[model samples]
Target: MKKVRGIYIKNSAEIALMREANRIVSVVLDALGEAVAPGVPTMRFEEIAQDMCRQFGVQPAFQGYGGFPYALCCSVNEEVVHGFPSRERILREGDVVSFDMGVVYERFYGDSARTFAVGTVSDAARDLLDATRESLHRGIAQAQPGNNLYDVSRAVQEFVEARGYSVVRRFVGHGIGRKLHEKPEVPNFVPSGMAGPVLKPGMVLAIEPMVCAGTCEVEILEDKWTAVTKDRKLSAHFEHTVAVTHEGPVVLSVS
Candidate 1:
């Protein structure tokens, strides 16, 4: 279903709490990023991330939320997102893993994701990740008051397609605050026709761009959560929780 929500701008005090939550989220990802290497088990990475969240007195936003069992979404290679962590699968050289995590502190939530290449990866895979990351930034640039949601989508779509890539249409970014997901569904690609309503100040959004190396089409695994490219090609994902302000779009989840 199409999601359209009005922006919910938080006050100064609420923004402060949200920043602290995001800071911990950043730390968790930093630890995970550093440990991402050949021979490391994804379950071990999840343990480290969960430990970090507990140390900060925060809760794993994904755990138990809509039946997501783990604290992190561990997607490796062809797996796009929501892959279950398992010790059975060890990280190998040239493999790329995407970690998507969310943390809640003082009642607010912060979510973000990063794709890391284990050891050395092929030029093609590296370029794919770079393009997806850049598309995220391009989408962020349009997140100001008075701009439509499609404006952000157009920026991301244009950049990815120009580079010979396509974005996953099934999942897109959404509003976030005290809850994991709120109003205003943010699409990474243009939604058939014109853009949605103009953006307004105080709206917090999680803008994630998932791009595929081949066709944009995707299929969910039998596991019922992990998504993968239908053509069996590679995909990359990058995300950031941003807030619209009079000053401009502020990326709250940057580490």
Candidate 2:
């Protein structure tokens, strides 16, 4: 590994290990997504995540991290992120849920998120999910060598706003590998007057775009971990672990 401007550039071997780590994340997310249904408790997803981690011989990265109690951040409806899973919080028809998951494999970390609709959702909710997912891909496309980090930020911001959604600013993405969060924070929106670091080969970034149908403003729930849209409107989130390579951006978290 090499550190340039405080950002760690992963070597070929490191990237390979990260690939396996992220692959596990993808598989787990697939299972979680498939399990979404009405009348199911959110805590069931956490149980599924733990079971999958064990079967894959990996460890749940979020469990106990920063005193977090659950393996999955199961944000429902207006909840933006860091949502706590509970048996009482059962899924209802037409609710949108976002599951942010992470895992540790051989000391490397993988992080990803996806929003799913429970049963049949409204047209507005469906649009939010589609736009959030596309925004993540747009940002990933900009993760190329010699490009400015803000380029990725700009892509996500513009694509999301153009679709009539607001990007959450309070919780941004970040570098991942060896640690859950690393140097050079990856914001969905570009900050004024900050160019950020130039993209380079071996740089791995967790590009997550959190979007809201209402205001971008966020409010923390009484639990202090769950983030909700201040206006109580719908929100969506999507993420992937991407690596900047000579050929272009490579998504490491795909199955």
Candidate 3:
């Protein structure tokens, strides 16, 4: 297993494996995106993602990872993240679905997510999704050699809060490599101090921002995994596994 630290660059072989793992994750997300629509069972989409991983000779990282028991996190409106796939939750018009996926190839991992609209989503919902995605870019811009992790967090928090949205605090981004959710948890909003470690080149991190249309507070479902906004308002999440490089930040999970 790769050692977990605040910041470190990977070697060429590790980079190659990570690229392959991220590629599978990217393709699986694209497949999931195409299959999501009104009247479609969420589990069907999860099955599609699982099938794609099998076809690619990779394993869904979330499946059996800490007993998650699902290939993908199919979060519908108001659900922040970790929504288990179920046949009963058929997506309907105006519903927003967030698909968070990860894959493991050759013992390396990649993670990413995208929130999609079912059909004819409300303008407010559209703005929330757009803002959440934009916050991803805003956060990634801070992943540089000379910057600290809080820079990334501050970037995400400022952008979302300025738009009257709240960043979910319970489930933040994480460092991922040979294992998913490694050391040095990356928060979407900065903590109250300057103690966060500085980023360095070759550090692979999944920078995901979960933005809530209502309050920042969240609650876990009965399954003890899916996190939902306390006020039942819509939420959006976007993510990309990124590596800090001398040139800039490069997103590993590209589609």
Candidate 4:
């Protein structure tokens, strides 16, 4: 691998290692998604993620990274991102929970996130989830060679706004490879006067979109980790680690 203008370009070998790392992330997330229920404690998902990481012989990428204590980030309704998993936080009917997870294998990192409804939810909550998820795919579709990085950002922003939703500006997507977070901060909205870097082959990015049913502004809770919407309204998050290749964007974080 080599760094060009602060962005790391992966070789074919390195990309293969990263694929394995991301596959582990996908497997663990699938398990967590299946375990989401109305009565389960949020911490149970963390335990399941840790066990899967051990079974796959990989490391929990978030654990101890910047002092994060758990393997998964369980963001409940109104929580935007980085919510700590806890036994005290129980899943309830009509609540939407977002699970953000990552794993490391052979020194490469893979990251992904998904928001799941606890049970039957309000129609507004369901619409928010659908729009947020669709926006993620729209962003990923723009991850191709010769496209400006902001192309992906614009795609996400436009889609979310068209549906009457707001994108979380404070937390953006990022590059991922040997390190969990890399250069080329991938914002969901395009900032004025910034064109961003050109997409190129071998560039891997974790494209995540956190959408809010209310205002885009958010505040960190007393825990200093959980971020909640200012209006205490519904929020949803979706993510996928994608690779820019000769053939276009290939989603790496998939089973």
Provide the lowest-lDDT 10-residue window in model 4: 20-29
- Of 1 and 2, the candidate ranking higher by lDDT: 2
For each candidate, the alpha-carbon lDDT, in order, equals: 0.88, 0.95, 0.89, 0.94
Q: Write the per-residue lDDT of candidate 4 for residues 146-239, one digit (tens) a residue.
A: 9999999999999999999999999999999988999889999999987699999999999999999999999999988899999999999999
User: Ranking under lDDT, best-scoring first?
Assistant: 2, 4, 3, 1
Error of 3 at 77 (Å): 0.4
Better by TM-score, candidate 3 or 2: 2
Give the local distance difference test score of model 3.
0.89
The regions of model 4 sitting more than 4 angstroms off are none
Q: Runs in model 3 with CA error above 4 Å?
A: 1-8
**Model 1 residue 135 CA deviation in Å:** 0.7
TM for candidate 3 is: 0.96
In candidate 3, what are the lDDT values of residues 106-212, reduced to their tens digit? 88898999999998899999999999999999999999987988899999999999999999988899888877887678999988845787787778889999999
Q: Residue 160 deviation, candidate 4, in Å? A: 0.2
Q: How badly does each model clash, as a count of residue pairs?
A: 2, 0, 1, 0
What is the TM-score of candidate 4?
0.99
Ranking by TM-score: 2, 4, 3, 1
Report the C-alpha lDDT of model 2 over 1-255, residue by residue, as the tens digit: 889999999999999999999999999999999999999999999999999999999999999999999899999999999999999999999999999999999999999999999999999999999999999999999998999999999999999999888999999999989999998799999999777999999999999999999899999988989999999999999999998999999999989
Using lDDT, give the best candidate's number.
Answer: 2
